[model samples]
Target: MTERVYYTSDALEMETDVVSCTRQEDGRFHVVLSATLFHPQGGGQPSDRGTINGVPLLQAIQDGHTLVHIMEGPVQPGKAHLLVDAEVRNLHTRYHSAGHIIGLAGEKFGWLGVKGNHKPGDGRIVFDALATPEPMTIEALATEIGALVQRSESRIITEAEGKRLVTWGTLKPYACGGTHVLNTAEIGDIRLIKMKEKKGQLSVQYELDA
Candidate 1:
């Protein structure tokens, strides 16, 4: 299994051994590394974009405990260097962290967060009303999330039962595996785009200010 560097560290560049590189039927090479800084496309987050040994990466996917990297070019099985795209990483991290704030706000309002998609430009949190939640307007929820953001609280990451739990300030901790910013202030201004309730689920869509 490739060590998931993105899970525990914020390192953007690193050198590791290339375990294997094989051409697939699609004509792209599947590369495996001893360790990886690239976050694979999963858990509602997109794959990390970057280059490995100068070969452009097409996508990274999770294959059980290991991550398989698809690249546009061939990579020899040997020592290799990886460089993760800082811009893409920052955008995803900020959006993911902000999504947590939305979840925190929803929870405070008696809405239980059941699902979320933290993809940039199309992020949202889905909540299920186990019981009829306290009446909450879209504006009120947005204001609550904004207030949480303005607090500029630091993010805390810890492990429990081998699962990673992410918390913002003293609120509830979420079992998350994606990358995130160190602090809520780094998320910038969060704009609630839309909120709708259907089939006993409330979906709140949001984005960050450019």
Candidate 2:
């Protein structure tokens, strides 16, 4: 397996690495680096978009053992320095952090168990719960998350089984590989755009203020 420069479950783990890299036929970079803060897109979370050595990375994806960075301009397949856009990284990290914050409603409201729910900015977080919100005024769930944002409490990060863990205000600790902000307050007033229930799954949609 190639070196995973960035591996903690921490989503906000941002850093830059410089090392030997290669350009693929499909127009992607085969990167072998010392260390990387950029996360390869996977697990339903969209791939990250940024630049490598000043060349814009079309996107990043994990292909088995290889972390590929698809780009536009030509790239050199040797040691090259790299930099990541802080803004892009932060946005992705914030969404990831918000995802966990949003899960609080289910965990607090009570859930039997939930699975297959991805981070926010992609879709809804749905799982088994003692109760799902009613069709009308389901927005209360979003309001609950808003309250957390209002509290602006710092979220603590830990490590378990090689994955970064985040915990907030008695909410269930979650294991994830994406980047995240330092605190729940950084989520910054997200708005739940929609809510739906289909085939016994509760789905809530939320977006950060732009």
Candidate 3:
């Protein structure tokens, strides 16, 4: 398994040994490193865009316990340097943290969070409110979430059991594996753009002006 350095530190670059390099059918090389700072595409967050040993990193994905970094050029099986795009990482971190805040807001309004997406420019959180006693408007939700953001009191807490939790202010924690900003204040000016209901599910779309 690749030691995921991003989980502990926000370092965008690292030097690690290339464990294996296999050429795929698509002609891209699947490179596995002993440790990596790249966050793979999972849990609604997109993959990190960067480079390995100066070669463009096309994609990063998890294969069981190991992370395979797809590269445009072949990387030799040896020590290599890994670097991630700071802007992309920052954008993803802020959006993912915002998702957690939106989830807390949903819970406050008696909505049950069922799904979420943290893709930049297209972030949203879905909730099931089949038993909700009252209708939730975008304005009300924005007010609630905006309040939390204004508090700027979010943190990433890891429990003894190794469960990663994202907490927004004093709200309850939500288990998450995606990258996030150190504080909710970094997610500036959140806007609830659209809300839709279908088949007992509420899709609340949002955007961040950072």
CA lDDT, every prediction?
A: 0.89, 0.63, 0.86
Cand. 3 Cα-lDDT: 0.86
**Candidate 3 has which clashing residue pairs, if any?**
none
Superposition TM-score, candidate 1 onto the true structure? 0.96
TM-scores for candidates 1 onward, in order: 0.96, 0.78, 0.94
lDDT of 2 by residue, 107-198 (tens): 55654335433344555566564655433345667677778777767766678787777676655677766666767777787777777667
Q: How well is each residue in 49-139 modelled by candidate 3, as lDDT tens digits?
A: 9999999998899888778998999999999999999998899888888888888888877888778888988998999874653667899
Q: Which of the two candidates, 2 or 3, achieves a greater lDDT against the reference?
A: 3
lDDT of 2 at 91: 75
Ranking of models by TM-score: 1, 3, 2
lDDT of model 2 at residue 67?
71
> Can you tell me which runs of candidate 2 are displaced by over 4 Å?
1-23, 112-122, 130-137
Worst 10 residues of 2 by lDDT: 8-17
How well is each residue in 1-210 modelled by candidate 1, as lDDT tens digits?
A: 898988889999999999999999989999999999999998878899999999999899988777899999999999999999999989988888888889889987789988889888899999998665888899999889888888877888999999999987876899999998888889998888899999888999999864
For model 1, the local distance difference test gives 0.89
